[model samples]
Target: MIERLENVVTFLDKYIAWMFVLVAVILFILLYLTYQCCLKYCARNLSKRDKPRHYRSSTLQYIRFTQVVKTPPRLSTDSHYQTIPLPNY
Candidate 1:
């Protein structure tokens, strides 16, 4: 058991630098994606901070009018989650 452990440790020691680089790249991608998502959500939520226009009607709207154009979902997760629209028979 000790010999097997030593061999595993030796293999990792040889590849430690590669593992570190791979982990760093994955973490950077995840952090960048999270930052982008947050920025999108914030931009969508934030409203005007400056002066109002001559008419506020253009700037103001009711919540009921918000519409999102969602793309079609994949086959697997779609079955588990929301039901996807089907073509007419």
Candidate 2:
């Protein structure tokens, strides 16, 4: 009975180790495929371009300012003002 138990434990340990290795290999394959896909996508997009135009200026001109006339403020009559009581919190 003890020998059978030891063999079973040994078998289980080997099985568990293989399972871990299989999982690691699968994850590595998936990550590599994802990386390759992203590289291909970036290469395809970067290769085609509508090239943007850049305009260069030789000299800067002085900005013109427009003068605005000030208008006089009208005084408000006392009847237009009102006071409200604040609510207690």
Candidate 3:
């Protein structure tokens, strides 16, 4: 089992190294950009500065799914044994 784990780790080490390298490169780029923007802010280079230097990017978007909204499920209760809902009037 230890040998198998070592073999798996060795195999995954290459992929993990590359992943870390990619993440490091991306972080370095972002940090450099932020540094440059900070320098510009300190130097007062721009004429108008309404917006922020770094814009936060969204990772996910809110979306509405019709299937989840339009349908209703049935359920049973121990006392009533039938699900009851108010009329949608």
For this target, which candidate reaches the highest TM-score against the unseen true structure?
Answer: 2
Q: Give the lDDT of residue 64 in candidate 3.
A: 21
| Candidate with best lDDT | 1
Evaluate all candidate structures by whole-model CA lDDT and list the values in order. Answer: 0.62, 0.59, 0.61
List, residue by residue over 45-81, the lDDT tens digit for candidate 1: 5643322343235533322122111445446763576
Residue 48 CA error for candidate 3 (Å)? 11
Candidate 3 accuracy as lDDT: 0.61
Model 1 residue runs over 4 Å out of place are: 1-10, 48-89
TM-score, candidate number 2 = 0.50
What are the clash counts of all predictions, listed in order?
0, 0, 0
Q: Which stretches of candidate 3 lie over 4 Å from their true place?
A: 1-7, 45-89
Minimum summed lDDT over a 10-residue window in model 3 is located at 55-64
Q: Identify the superior model by TM-score, candidate 1 or candidate 2.
A: 2
All candidates' TM-scores?
0.41, 0.50, 0.39
Q: Which residue pairs come into collision in candidate 2?
A: none
**In model 2, what is the error at residue 39, expressed in angstroms?**
0.3
**Per-residue alpha-carbon lDDT of candidate 2 for residues 1-89, written as tens digits (9 for 90 to 100):** 99999999999999999999999999999999999999998887764332222211211211110011123334456766543432222
